[model samples]
Target chain A: MLLSVEDFGIEFHDHDSPERVVEGVSFTLDKGEILGIVGESGSGKSMTALAIAGLLPRKKLKKEGRILFEGEDVLTMERHKLRGLQGDEICMIFQEPMTALNPTMKIGLQVEEALRIHHTEMNDAQRKERAIKWLKNVELDDPERVYESYPHQLSGGMRQRVMIAAAMVGNPQLLIADEATTALDVTVQAQIIKLLQKINKESQVAILFISHDLSLIRQISHNVLVMQNGHLVEKGAVDDIFEHPQQEYTRKLISAIPRVEL
Target chain B: MKKWLKKHKNFNFIAGAIITGVLLLTVLIGIFATPYDTTQMNVADKFAKPSFAHWMGCDNYGRDILSRVMEGMGNTFLIAVLTVLIGTVFGVIIGALCGYFGGLLDDILMRINDVLFSFPSILLALVIISLLGTGRLNVTLALGIAFIPSFARIVRSEVKKQCSLDYVKSAALMGAGHMRIIFVHILPNIMPVLLSSVMIGFNNAVLAEAGLSYLGIGVQPPAASLGRMLSEAQSFLFTAPWYAIFPGLVIVLTVLGFALLAEGTTEEE
Candidate 1:
């Protein structure tokens, strides 16, 4: 297994109450596989992803369980080692591309920053050239123009593409995209999904795609994990689960997707 | 220029630029040239009226008031600049640490800041100066300490707001360290707000320095300071009213210039 999350749980502590947000979640992902996690708004899917990245709020939350990436326990890993893993071994792309990018920075510099931090062997000129190449790989029409422009200067779809380029510049083994396309319109969403599919095929990088949209998940995910209110309600091959959902919650969630008949 | 001003609605910008420019220019001019030797005393020509030779007349020590006022502007400007610089460097580091690593560290730092904040800034400066003893450098140190709480408070709140933004979280996830996230990602975003507040801090520091000097604990004797001139002229307020009036006017101009400049920058933002 490339990544194995065993008995993963998360609890948020409040002054009056301690809420268990993610409970006993277990799953495994292999190299070059796409694992889609689908759930509603408060279903703890995002928390699970954040936990994998060690991005949860430190003071307010407690995480339990082991996340072994390449047989190394992520939770117990040294911070310096974990930092090395982040953006290099297991990168992530966030939702809301409009805000995910630093508005004051040029897109090229933002992408170059990722390379500059992780790839110490690459000089400034090499980092800039590689960042531009990544931008082109994401299918940006004028990579140079997009590279020179600020985040606010580009459209939402274009900015998201720049974000993807930044995340992928390091060419990590796994990419955790947390609702990465949810904020876009249907057409742009389809384009980004297709782009992700292309990147996965070409690079053979594993992806853990999280979203609330069932159809979108079905379009790209080979294996699907269904979550409901902090628990993994169902998990299976996408075809098997979509064609015949074993759990009532899974069936209800699949049925909730609006379908059009010819 | 009038048309450009009207187009941009930059009345405050123009006014601020002009007043601050003229005042700073006076300081620069004072460095090389004054109406007469600032410290030279001529008891024969003491209390001379505001004439062409000695523009603002002579002081009690027969020193040219205009020359002394110009020299005092230099001292006042130095104190304000140093105070703001010292306060900002320490303030930004403390605020960033408190805001970024919010928990026990934040609680402790903020409480200390609160204790400092509770006192009137001038009183705090007076206390500090008393302990450090009086001089230009001591006054700068005192005012700088007094200015820290306000700068820290402003920077802390600004950093807090910036930290909650997605860009900061994204940077962290991208393996940027805490220092990198704070300095590279958060600082630039909060700089405009921080800078405007620093300008306001500059205004307050100038006033506080004057207050300390007027209390006879800042910029000791023979070193011309606007506040000291005002204090000396108190006894001759009626006879040598020009002595008090000129320095008082310069102080007002300096404070107003900084206040308006701050307002102008905020509006531009």
Candidate 2:
């Protein structure tokens, strides 16, 4: 497994009360495969991603799990080692591209920042050059203009493309895309997914794509993990789960998708 | 850029311009002019009327009011800049720590802030100046302490908000440390707000200086300050009104400059 999560659980503690937000989940992703964790809001799909990355709220959230990234227990990894791995080894793309980006920052410089931090060997001109290259790869029109423009200047789809370029530019082995395309319109969403699909195929990067849209996940993901109220109710090959859902909740969720009647 | 400026349609552009223009004029005029030395107390020219020789007239001490106002503007600006630096540096650190770490640290820092907040800012400054004694440095220190809670509160809130953002979580999952996430991702995001707050704080710093000087706890009389001028002019208002007029205008313009800059940069984040 490229990434193996064993018996992971997360509990968020409020000053007033403490409760388990996510409990007892296990999954694995092989090299270059896409794993989709699908559920409604509060189902803990995002939380699961956060736990594997070891980015849970340090003080408020209690974690118990073994997350193995290439046979290394990431849960127990030293902070310095973890820091080196983030962006360089595993990166994330947030949902709302505009809010996710530093508004005042130029798009190209923002994209290059990940490389600058993780790959300190690269100088300013080299980073800028690579950023422009990736900008074009994302099929952004006028890469130079986009590079100089701030986050607010870019359209939502364009901003998400910039984010995708930034997240992928670091050449991370694993990419966690949390609702990465949900903020865009349906057409823009399809374009972003296409871009992501292209990147995953070309780079052979493993992706954990978290989204509420089942059909969208069905299109991109190799395996689907159906989650309900923080529990992994079902998991199987994307084709298998879609064809013959073993769990009632999974079956019900799949049935809820609007169908066209002749 | 002109179209963008026009689109704002807010008091920000025009008011900001007038404010900056006035302050710039003060700085420029100060650099090149003198019917009498700002500090020179010539008993011969004492209390002279407005003329080409002394446009703003003379004070009771025979110092040229225009020269005094010019020197005062420079001193006032120096104090505001220094105090703002001290306050903002201290505030950002405290706020970042309290907001990021939370728990007992946040509680302790916030409680301290609450205590400071309760003490009317000017009164707190007065008390500190009274205790530390008076001077430019002391006034700056007092004013800085008085203004810190505002910045700290704003920074703390910004930190808390940024901390919850998905990118911050994403950065963390990737293995970025708390320091890296805080400084690199979070700090840069919150900076626009911080910049606006700093501009506002600068305005407050000038106002605080004037208040302190007027109350006799700021820059001593040999120094020219708008507030000191106002206080001195109170006694001579029946005779020479220009003593108060020029310095008052300077203070108004100074505050307006910072206020305009703050407004222009407010939406930057």
Candidate 3:
């Protein structure tokens, strides 16, 4: 197994109450396979992703569980060790591309920065070369021009592509995409999905695709894990879950996909 | 580079040019030009009116007023620059750390800032000067300390907001150390605001220095400062008005240049 979680639980400490978010959640992601985590906004899908990456807000959170990445316990690691594991071993793509990037920073410099930080051995020339290469890997046209442009100057789709390029430049083993395509228009969404699919195929990197849209997840994911109120409702192969869901919530979620006339 | 330059406004460029020219002129005058040694006194030339020999006229001590004002401009720039440097660096470090790290650290640092803020800056500066004893160094320390709260408050809020940004979170995920996230990702992004803040703070530094001098605790006599010049000119305002006028004009020009530059930078942002 590439990544595995066992008996993981997260809770928020309020003044008078401790609200549990994810409880006893367990799953595994294998190499080159896309694990689709399907849930609504508050279903704890995003929180789980944050826990895997150690990006969850710590002050209010009471996290208890074992998050094993490549056989090491992530939750138990020191801050420095956890940081070392985050971007190099596991990378994440956020939902909103517009806000994901710093507006003042040049798109190319942002991508290059990821490389410079994680892979310190690489020189500036190598980082720039890798940035340009990754930009084109996402099929962005005029990568040179786009690199020089600031985040605000780019369109939503282009910014998302730039984000993807930044995430992929580290060549992380596990890619966690959190509502990655939710902000784009339908057509642009399709294009970004296609781009992600291409990257998955070319790189053979394990991906954890989190989103609410079951149909969109079905398009790219090999296995599906449905979450509801911090609980894992169902887990099976993508086709198996679609055809033979064992839970009511899973069936209802799958059925809720809007039907379109041809 | 040319395209970016082309986008620059006429007023910003003009104002920046004027400020740069004045700073350079002051520096040059300090380094080289002076008809008479600023400290040398000629009793015979006392109360001499504006003429080819002594363009501005003589002070009460028969020292050259024109040379004194030029020297004062240089000293003013030095004090302002030093004070701002100390305030901005120390303040940014304290504020960024407090804002980035919340809980007890944030509460403690911010409460201290609040206490500092409660006292008016000038009054606090006065209190500090009185304690440290009157001198150029004391005045600079008082003014720099007085300005620290403003810098701290501005940087604290900027850091708090920036720490929540996706890029910062992303950097954290990218194995960036906390220092890296604070200095690299967050600091660079907030630099434009910080730059503007520093410029405005420098303007306040200049004004505060002047005010302290006007109150008689600033740069002492024998050392040329626009404020000291003005303080000495108060007695002869009716007759040798040029003593006040020359230094007063230099102060206005210096202040105007900085004000215009600051306004332009704020607009650009």
lDDT of 2 by residue, A1-262 (tens): 7999898888877666878878889999999999999999999998888766656656766788788999998878887887788878888888888678776567877788678778889999999999999899999999999999998888989988888888888888899999998988999899888988999999999999999999999999999999988889999999999999999999999999989999
Q: Cα deviation of B95 in candidate 2 (Å)?
A: 2.5
In candidate 3, what are the lDDT values of residues A1-262, reduced to their tens digit? 8999998999999557999989989999899999999999899999999999888776877998899999998877888888877877899999888778887778888888767777889988898899999999999999999989999888999999998898889898999999999988999999999998899999999999999988899999999999999999999999999999999999898788999979
Among residues 3 or more apart in sequence or in different chains, the pairs in candidate 2 whose N, CA or C atoms overlap within 3 Å are: A86-B174
Query: Would you list the rank order by DockQ, best first?
Result: 1, 3, 2
CA lDDT of B130 in candidate 3?
90
Q: Which stretches of candidate 2 lie over 4 Å from their true place?
A: A15-17, B1-12, B28-33, B171-180, B256-269
- Candidate 2 docks with a DockQ of 0.49
Label model 2 with its docking quality class. Answer: acceptable
Candidate 3 residue-wise lDDT, B175-262, digit = tens:
8888877877788777888888888788788888887888889898788888888888999999889989988887777777777777
Alpha carbon lDDT of residue A143, candidate 1? 92
lDDT of 1 by residue, A92-188 (tens): 8889998899988889989987777888999988998899899999999989898899999999899889888999999988999999998999899
Off by over 4 Å in 3: B1-9
Better of 2 and 3 by TM-score: 3
Clashing pairs in 3: none
Winner on DockQ between 1 and 2 is 1
User: Candidate 1 regions off by >4 Å?
Assistant: B1-7
Name the top DockQ candidate: 1
Weakest lDDT window of 10 consecutive positions for candidate 1 chain B:
B4-13
